[model samples]
Target: MTVLFWVCTIGILSLFLIWRNHSDQKKAKERFRDLKKTQYGASPNRNSGEEALSHVSHFFEDHRQENAIDDITWNDLEMDSVFARLNYCESAAGEEVLYDFLRNPCRLNASERARLERQIELLQTDGDVRLQLQYQFYMLRQRGKFSIYDYLHLLDQEKKRRNGKHFLLLFLLILSLVCCIFSVSGAPLFLVGMICVNMITYFQEKGRSDAYLSVFYYVLRLLGEAEKLERIHHERLQETFALEL
Candidate 1:
C-alpha cells in the first residue's frame, strides 16, 4: 500500500509539472504572435507612421558610418517595409544587425549577392530552420531597447575603482566562516550580524552598480544567444553564424 501511494504521488507530481510547462509554452507562443502582429500590422494613423520613421532615422543617425546606407536612399527604397518583411530575427542584436544590413547596403559583388540571395531563398523555404532560429531569438530578447554598443561605451566610461565596503564585507564573511569551522560559541551571532551589515551596505551601493550590472547582464545574454546560434546547423546561416562568433 505504501509503495503504491508513493508511486502515485510521484506520477501526479510529474503530470502537474508537465502541464505547467505546456501552459507556459502556450502563453509564450501567444505573446510572440501578438508581438509579430504589432510589429508588422498596419499603422492606425499617419502620426504612427511618422513616429516609426523618426525612430528608424534616429537609430541610423546614431550608428551610421561613412559607408553605411544613407537616410535618403533608405526612404527612397522603402527599406523600412523591406525590413519588416524580412525580419524574423528573435534577438535585439539580430534585429539591429538586420536593420543595419538593410539601411547600409553592403558592397557585395555580383557573385556574393547571388550567394546571399540563395541563402535567403533557403531560409524562406525551410520553415523548421526559421522556426528554430526564431525560438532562439525569442529566448534572447530583452525587456527593453538595449543597445549593446551604447551600454559597452557607458561601461568603458565608468571608473575602475573598487569599493572598500565590498572588501570589508568579504573579509567579514571569511572571518565568520573561519569562526564557524573553529566551533566558536558566538560564530552564528557574528554571521548574522555580518549578514545584516552586508544587506545594509548592499542596498546603499545598489544604485551606483545597477547600470554596470545591467550592461553585464545583457552582454552575458548576447553571448548565450551567440553560442546557441553557432550550434544551429543551417547551411544558409553558416557564414553569418561564423561571423557572429
Candidate 2:
C-alpha cells in the first residue's frame, strides 16, 4: 500500500514539470521573432547593403545623431536582411569579421576612422536614417562583448543535472533490495521505506530530465544567435569594403 502511494505522488510531479518546459519553449520562439523585427526596423541605408552596418555601429554609439537622418533613407537599410546575412555566410571574413570589428572597432586606423566618420557625416543629412542607425549602434554596443565562458557555464549546468539522475536511480535500486528482504522476514514496516524510496526517485528523475532538455535548448538558441551575427558581418563587409577577396 505504501509503495502504491509513493508511485502516484512522484508520477504527478513529473507530469507537471514536463508541461512547464513545453510552455517555456513556445514563449521563447515568440520573443525571438519580436526581437528580430525590432532590430530590423532600427537598421539604416538598406540599398547600400553592408556599408550601412559600419554606420550602424556608429549610429548605436550616438543615438542623438539619429535625428540627422531621414525615415525614407533609413528604411532603405534592411536590418532583417543584414541579420539574415549574419545567419548564413560561413566565411571567417563574412559574419565573423563584423564580430571581430565589433570586439574592437576602436583599434581601426586613423584613415579607417576618418572614412567611417565621412560616411556617417553623409548619412546624417537624412533625419530618419541617422536616428534609426544610431539606435541600433547604441543597443548593440551595449550588448557587451561575447564570452565563451558564459556559454560554457550553461553547458556545465546541464551536465550537472544529468549527473544527478544517476544517484536517484541508485537510491531506488537499494530500496528495492530492502523491500525484498523485509517481505521474506515478515518485517511489515519495510514496505513503508520502499514506498518512500520509489516516490522520491520518480519525482527526482522527472525534474532532472526537464532541466537537461532546457539546457540543450539554450545551447541551440545561442548558436542560432551567433549565426545571425555572422551573416550580417559577411554581407556588410563585402558591401562596405569589398573585402570578399
Candidate 3:
C-alpha cells in the first residue's frame, strides 16, 4: 500500500511538472510573437536616436576595451536599423551582446571574417538550427532590466558584507538532529526550535540576497546559452563561444 501510494504520488508530480512546463512554453511563445510585432513596428525618431547615442557613450566609458566601434560609425552606417532587422535574439544577454557587437565591431582578420560570413550564410539557410537556438534564447528571457555585468562587478563588496550567521545556524541544526537521534530528553523540542530558527534565518538571508537574484538568474541563462551555442558545429563561432564560456 505504501509503495502504491508513493508510485501514484510520483506519477502525479511528474504530470503536474509536464503541464507546468507546457503552460510556460505557451506563454513564452505568445510573448515572443508580441515582441516580434513590436520589433517590426519600432521606428526610433531623432530624439530616440539621440538618447540611444548617449547611452552608447556610457558603455564606451564604462568598458574601455579594444576593437570597440564608435557611435558615429554606427550612425553613419545606419546599423541601428540593420540591427533591428537582424535582431532575432530572444535573451537579454544575447540582445546586449549583439548590440555591443554592432556598436564595437570585432576586428576579425580576413580569414576569420570570411569564415564568419560563411557561418552566417549557413545560419540564414538552416531554419531548424535557427529555430532551436531561438527557442533556447526565448526560454532565457529575463523578467526585468537587470545588468549581469554590473552586479558581477560589485561581487567583492557583496562578499565583504556577508556574515557567517547562516553557517552557524546550519551547524546548530545538525547538532540538534544528532541529539534527537540519540534519544535525549527535550531533544525533540530542541530540534524543532532549531528548525524554526533555521527557517527564519533562511528567509531573512534570502530576502537580503533577493537583490542579486535577477543578476544571478541572467548569468546562469547566459552560461546555458553559451553551452548550447558551443555545441553547434560552426568553427567561426567556436572561438567566440569559447570566450563566452
User: Any runs in candidate 2 off by more than 4 Å, and if so which?
Assistant: 1-216, 228-245
Which consecutive 10 residues in model 2 have the weakest lDDT in total? 138-147
CA lDDT of each candidate? Answer: 0.69, 0.48, 0.65
Write the number of the candidate with greater TM-score, choosing between 2 and 3. 3
The best candidate by TM-score is 1
Provide the TM-score for each candidate, comma-separated. Answer: 0.57, 0.28, 0.56
Candidate 2: C-alpha lDDT: 0.48
**Per-residue CA lDDT of candidate 1, range 1-245, in tens?**
99999999999999999999999998987786565556543432222244433333334456677888766787798877777666555555665666766765764678878877876776567656656666667777643444555656677687787778689898998899899999999999999999899888888778777767877887788788778778888665676333467
- lDDT (tens digit, per residue) of candidate 3 on 139-180: 776434444555666665775554587788888899999998
Model 1 residue 213 lDDT score: 86
Query: By TM-score, is 1 or 3 better?
Result: 1
* Model 2: per-residue Cα lDDT over 131-151, one tens digit each: 333333322322112232333
Ranking by lDDT: 1, 3, 2
- After superposition, which runs of candidate 1 have C-alpha atoms over 4 Å from their true positions? 1-63, 72-86, 107-111, 165-204, 233-244
